[model samples]
Target: MVQLGSRAGAPGRHVVLCAEQISKSFAGVRALHNVDFDLRHGEVHALMGENGAGKSTLMKILAGVHTSYDGSIQVEGQAASFSGVRDAEEAGIAIIHQELNLVPELSVAANIFLGREPLIGGVLIDRRSMIRAAERLLARLGVTIPPETRISGLRVGEQQLVEIAKALSLNARILIMDEPTSALSSSECDTLFKIVRQLASEGVAIIYTSHRIEEVLELADRVTVLRDGRRVVTAPIGELSRGAIISAMVGREITANESGKTAQDGAVVLSVRNLTLDTLGPHGWRRTLHGVSFELRRGEILGIGGLLGSGRTEILESIFGVSRGWRDGNIAIDGAPVDINSPADAYRLGVALVSEDRKERGLHLGASICDNVALPSIGVLSRFGLRSFASERALAADMVKRLSVRCSGIGQDVAALSGGNQQKVVIGKWLGTEPRILLLDEPTRGIDIGAKQEIYRLIFDLAAQGLGIIVVTSEMPELLLLSDRILVMCEGRQTGILARENATQEQVMRLAAPGMAAWSQVSAS
Candidate 1:
């Protein structure tokens, strides 16, 4: 853990970045009140807050993404005004947003040097040199990516690396990262942390934001608490434990999930046997899901646990009918075979999925909250080849109320909402479908504690109504609390199935670990 602060005014050491009495508002609703914050050179400053706590608003003001904020920002002991993101970059500040800003059609090199590419003799374009330069920059950040590869061909983790490389290419003095590790696996996160340490060593000021308190303690040199747009306290990482940080962030006590919930009423509602997908990949017709089988019951929550590339995602994909063609499978809903060839087909048969990646697979960010929330039920809102906008708005308003979604209005753009609110919209969209079965993939991964609690309550509510739910999550405590049973996968095989009564963190880890069990026997015990 990092120490909170050093002695006051000991020699020529002042903050490199400082904000005084910052305030912001939208339509008379104050998002951030008078808040003061600072970042010193060679320090990792963690910003802590919950949904609607105004952390993002403050960061946006500092990044110059919002010019209407009222504040005095001093850089290197001189007051400065930044009108736009470019101005901030020019001031040696860079922000890697949670939502990646890369163009998919462009190559890695092109994205890294997007607006400011090095020129050949200040005239002709130098493509080869740009690629080499991008490669070197990526290497410096401990990121391995092919510069010539199109960003569209990469996974979410690889694309995140591209964003980091872009920040490094600017040689920025201050770097801001918003939930950079929300989608990264353990190893990939290790790579990112290594780069953070390296940059801190070079005197680059860093402002880090994340929902994971443990990660903040491990990586941040100092922690800053923000609540309802007010600065609470700034302390060294070593000065605060995870419990204290959570209490400060939420302004309340949060009991950890110490024990697992007991399974109840386990009559199977969904059953699949001998499910196999033989698709040609880098390896020929490789068995991605080898005779996978599982059982889920009415009013039950089943968990699927595994690391990246452990076939956990494939199982969800197969169940949702999004995977490559599969063969010889017996899928039953209430002991009846159901044909599922597409998402619409599965949906019609009463199945809905909150996919693993929300931005790509779930939402249309440019669309309004009304449109996104009502998308799944548009047919019902449509009549005589015409849609009723009023009806759609009413339905959206109701769903928003039910989900406790925070937003400006149903007419507000989804992209403008906070990350947790955006995720709520995704769930609301699915809830509008009114499915009998729900498959959620990492549903609460990036959300704050308050929003997460809402989602958990919603899950239990849905299950209480007798809707069978299967959740795939990397967070073990979530599995313990939200799931009635867990199915562990290791390398495209079913390793073990533990009921909540018998499921311990150690048991789930063992089943999800290497060389445990095959997919054929993974159960919903």
Candidate 2:
């Protein structure tokens, strides 16, 4: 439905962008190696690789997100040095990252034209001109959202489209889309694909990257697969098979059930009855959750599934004693009623939580892994009034080795680590507390496939060791693969809890949409 660009034919088929001898490293660990890439105008070239394959690193270098990498990029047959993101934009290059980048407090139009706003009389910002420009832009993108709508109010799919509109506004000849479909629904993805093809037809050279192999195969004119930071294969999409691309990704064949299933018949370890929460507004308070209840058993992986704003996160935060609106709830652990009013109470009761935002809530970015892993259990690791540095180091080293975190050393800062390794450090730090129950919220959200498998295996191992675990995820394949039982939530209420053997995507989706249907039923695993 979107009109991306002028329908004029390309001047001619030619290579518009090229990179030579691209290499990047973080703290002595090589992330890329001599990766040569070139993009032809009017082509959709997909960059494929497993997590840690340097696909993102390579794209970052091209987009001027990382200017320190060892590489030489040529734009339009001329050697160009991009000093920063603005430089790349000036050179007709724009990128839409996997994580939607929009200021939540600003209006949609303000975000679309963030830096280069039209000014009147060389003085005040032209708000009226900005809205007109934004309206025209959104209409071209086939989106109906108002120009004045706050970004925070828009859904994920809508935000993604706004990002696309922003890039299109730049009029970039070379556009890079990184994992653009990750947050989109099926219909949203179809819309995105249609726009991508339209743009390509108008002579826009596109660099498309995604973890979904089928998507790459369908949309990409050429495919380039990277492994261990090196280019393994680059060829026309017709010349590559799905299995071949996958095998090149990980150097092995992987099955749908990567970690396999657990017995899932252990004793009930956590029981919740009639939990409720309310958001305090200026006038008073507004209710969110309505008497939600469920049970989690040891040696079992329970999944929470729902659409955005379904209160799936509220369930985890409330259970971990971090929710401000835990109005009434009865939580019993090991057949005894427990009161967890704070995170300390949850920790003391052998419960651990890995929040959705690992960077903000889980890890201290400036601190070393050694300090981070020992943070929660400092009291247990200490002797007398003074904390023992030696014990902390030993514990940190043990956790590093146990989790197989890819880092230069345990003394390295967590902020420098990759997305996957940062998550591992978060998991290791939490596991150091030796929790009997673990609650993970969107654990693999921004991570790669390989890292996801590692997390899945770790969860299975923990469950096998009699640790009860609850995972909340929006990824349907992940929920189907890991959950021994699935609980669907809608508008902060329990819609249904389904046994693993009988649970299906259609049923879960139905329950996820509020008032879509009468909940089939709910039963404990």
* Global local distance difference test of model 2: 0.84
Model 2: per-residue Cα lDDT over 362-440, one tens digit each: 9999999998999998999899978999999998999889988988898999987877789999999889999999999
Candidate 2 total steric clashes: 0
- How far is 341's C-alpha from truth in model 2 (Å)? 3.1
CA lDDT for candidate 1: 0.81
Q: In candidate 1, what are the lDDT values of residues 478-511, reduced to their tens digit?
A: 8788888888877777778887778888888777
Separately for all candidates shown, the number of backbone clashes (residues 3 or more apart, or on different chains) is 7, 0
Q: TM-score of each candidate?
A: 0.86, 0.85
Regions of candidate 2 where Cα sits further than 4 Å from its true position: 2-14, 23-31, 68-72, 98-109, 128-165, 181-198, 201-203, 255-264, 280-287, 324-326, 513-525
- Residue 191 accuracy (lDDT) in model 1: 70
